[model samples]
Target: MAYAEEYAPTTADPARIGYALVPLLDYFEGKTLMYVRGATCRGYVEWRTSMVRANHANARTEARRTRTVSSATARKELGVLSAAIGFWHREHGPLESVPVVTLPAKPEPKPDVLDRSEMARLLGGALGFYQLEWCDLETRQLHRTLKRDHSAINRHTARFIVIGRYTANRPGATMKLRWMPNTVGGWPDFKRELLYRKGSEVVESKKRQPSVRLGRAALAHFRRWKAIDDRAREDLARRTDGMATSFLCVVHWGGEPIKDIGKSFVTALDFAGLPRHYTPHVLRHTRVTWWVEAGLSLEEVADAAGMTTQMVEEVYWHRSPHFQKRAAEA
Candidate 1:
């Protein structure tokens, strides 16, 4: 820092450590990291612990009483400070000292996910639900079974579950998906496969920008979903263009994105008899673990699962002989 100051007296330090924790906490809070400190640091653990304990009284379907703040949460919070310090150093040269953070340590385990059978049960259960309003059974010239085919919930949640598993995308990123035709969005070849852009919001903060490629099944589902929406409301579907739908998500009566799906996800999980702690994040871990176990390299798994190679090696399973033997190569 002295050297940097000496060399360029006009330059100011990129970061200032001589301050209370509130401002820094505020700055980091907006980002995706676990940026807990000050009041949040004091309250977060207690609040989470109380949430779990309270659930015990109302634990009808979920065994969420044991869920509480994890060591991983604390680790990430500390890492935020470390990252801030590093960023400052890179911008304004090295600092002699920075704030020292002590993080609580605990045993780290591999992330858990549903098994194949559980996945099937969840999908089947979601598909079984019938949305009477969306399905015009009385007016349609069809039988009972045939008219029940138009389930908006099934298209959204069940298909969402399927796409989430295959792509291993963050739920937010998956929901933000848009399908752009080749001719419209500077893509000259329409036959160049069904490509999905996860959009700038998803990639702006991320280091490795992703090119999301839809699998055959995903492509077919998207196509079918768009067709269904268009068939249901031909006028609204013509808003974007004569091309693909504006979003690759299931919409409501007015084509507005459903703000929350937690309730439906819970019902699906209960139907599948899965652990209550299982969430959409588990899909990422499952995909990474499955790929690693199936002999994909750490980098390969990271690319497919939207994670870093280090994360894949650390959070998935580290004891695999395949990863162990090729540690030097990575």
Candidate 2:
């Protein structure tokens, strides 16, 4: 609790440490640091996996069952425990020795990418209306309606998709962007055609959030969004006697910032006739894949995607058209 609170304000994710620590606290209750060993860590992994799997088994739907917890989650939780112990030792120590926390092998990355046609379909779903079916309770009749009356159905999600696809930013970093510069979230500089993807005051995490230059299409969308937001703000100010204000780049119709778009994104996927397994993170993957396929140098792609060159070579170079071309020719 102390370590979590201490680093909460500085971390990009304020709740992650605390959330990971909850199960650890429950399991390690009354146990001293001396009791923490490789076997104990492995035991915790088993216990946590079984508990979550049991709950998942009780879920009534296939989708819910498929969301079972993996060993990766257990590894993260135990990593938090290890970090907490290390912090304690550094800050105030007299401990004889610290036990190493055992972790499961890292899982292989999922190979999922959206092709150009699929990308277009996804954007269409976000920007256009789709048919919705519902059963009328009184008449017991099935009805289909074109859901075009409400703008909230997919407007914010559309912006999210465009930004995510262009910037190759993580979903969280993309959603945290704003039009105006601030200390709490990233902001775009339209004149410079650059996007600062991390706040000035936020401490950098292992996952980098480097600035990226915007493409012409992305810049045009940002300009249009700014104009729309400015018009909306002015109208709201007049209606409320100059009391309305907003700074977020991605917003609903009324200018309120959207916290999460998972459900709406899934709806867009359904509308586009795509798989539900394609998550928002897949946008980043798609962008990286496209870059590699275009024969962009590893250094350039790594810098744009805020990843190390080694990672790009290891994980994405295989997608390149020129990959092993010399060897194949020989």
Candidate 3:
């Protein structure tokens, strides 16, 4: 399920790599006439075949060997040139499969966890600069950028990040803008309807949807963010109507929505000087780790993170090796 982001791992046959790349063939149909008139030769055909094969590196290698192009130069041209030729041939008939070449398995790397001190530094760094204020050195451009223009956009971003990090929802499930406004009403509303009801959280052929309540400290931080959002929206004519009709998150600011916020999380983390891996998903992992360290039952952490208890135990339970080692030392 996690591998869905990289590949369509759900396909019944994994051997036909880019089995999902099948549907994309339609897009190339428009380019058919241009390719048919272009260059045709042993070198071009070999290189072209490699491009269609799916493994990018192999395509480059085949192109270099066929054309006597240097290894370095071939890599640059492989994707662009090979793709052009491949699209041309797709209209005529099915291309032959790339020869399967298996390499010996390498040792898998162990997963690493941040120590408690490192975790403290990350959260501290994030909060220390949460209220964004921009300054221009040359002109003294001190302006309140958080004005009436983007209030709805900011609230939506806050809600998705808050709910996704707290709940560990998959991107598809959590990024759906329709469900967000109801969830952001906070824990009381969440607990009354979403939890205890079995199917309330579960989507068909999709993962269980858990309702996550923030910690006392996290809730305090969120309340501060909400206040800022409210002030930003206050200047608009008829602010109450704007709040009532629009979704908490919308595409008002530069045509961006809350769903686009995840990309910006990495840039924000870089600004805060935290490790690059400290993205929103890392916060999800950190929440689960803290619950386990605090002696919450595995089942509780799993439900909170929208996963099976076994997954939480398998992924994060070993994070605090010091606690286990302390028992033996004692």
Candidate 4:
């Protein structure tokens, strides 16, 4: 718990560490390192997988459902536990041997990439308003309403989608982008047509966020968003006597940076006529898949997508036009 709280803020995805580690503390609180073994690890996995979690799909009704956890999730949690043990050993122990942390076999990758048409629909949905029609049972009349205006409340999500589609950044990195260089988050340099995905002070994590060049479409969106933000800032300053506003490129109408877009993203999925499985992370997969299908070299795609060439080949090479061409020809 102490280690997690100390390092969570420094991680690329603090929420992930927090979520994975907190529950682990409950199960392993009274236990020692010696208590961790193959059987114990398997027992932990079984216990975790048997537990039920809330179903967000029926959140409106405050419904509860029995959603069994996956081995992947258990593995991540145990991985954190393993890391904590290692840290303990390194910092304080000259003790005997380190215990081997048993982990489940890695699951096969199920990369779900969106097609161009689907991406277009998603972007359109993010930029448009919702149209709702329903019958008024009390009045016995049909009514139409336009609510949940994206331009007003969820415009930030549109910017997020555009940047994600072009840069293939993780959702957390996309949300951390600002208009100017800062010590905390990345910024876009419109003049140079590049995106510096991490601040100088930010440490690089396992998931890389290397700087990437911006495409014309992404640059145009950045410029337009900057102009709109500038105007909004000026208006706010005039009204509020120089009140400070967020420098983040993606923000609400009031210029506040959004902390989470889960609900808004779900609304976007619905508007795009996409299934629930289509998530924000799919934008990154879609961009990589598109680059592969377009005949971009593995190295180029890896660098642009902040991934290793090995990972590209392993997970996405099958999407490339040249994947098995030589074999097929032979």
Task: Give each model's whole-structure lDDT.
Answer: 0.52, 0.82, 0.43, 0.80
In candidate 3, what are the lDDT values of residues 164-210, reduced to their tens digit?
Answer: 44444444444443313442212223233331112232322224555
Rank by TM-score (best first): 4, 2, 1, 3
Top TM-score: which candidate number? 4
Q: Candidates sorted by lDDT, descending order?
A: 2, 4, 1, 3
Q: Which runs in model 1 stand beyond 4 Å of their true positions?
A: 1-67, 77-97, 129-153, 180-191, 194-197, 201-203, 206-209, 237-254, 317-330
Each candidate's TM vs. the true structure? 0.60, 0.86, 0.45, 0.87
lDDT for each residue of candidate 1 in 1-330, tens digit (9 for 90 to 100): 232233222212111221222333544556533333455544543333343443255556564545554555545544545555555666775666554444455456657866676677667656653222344678765333211223424546776687667667655544444333331111111255434434332213343435555667766776776677656555645765455443434423245556555666776666555766777667656656667777877777777666777777777756455855656776
Give candidate 3 misplaced runs (Cα > 4 Å).
1-202, 222-234, 237-247, 250-256, 277-279, 320-330
Residue 324 error, candidate 2, Å: 2.0
- Of the two candidates 2 and 4, the one with more favorable TM-score, higher being better, is 4
Clash pairs for candidate 2: none
Instruction: Pick out the ten consecutive residues of candidate 3 with the lowest summed lDDT.
Output: 98-107
Error of 1 at 64 (Å): 4.8
| Model 2, runs deviating above 4 Å | 53-63, 94-96, 128-152, 251-253
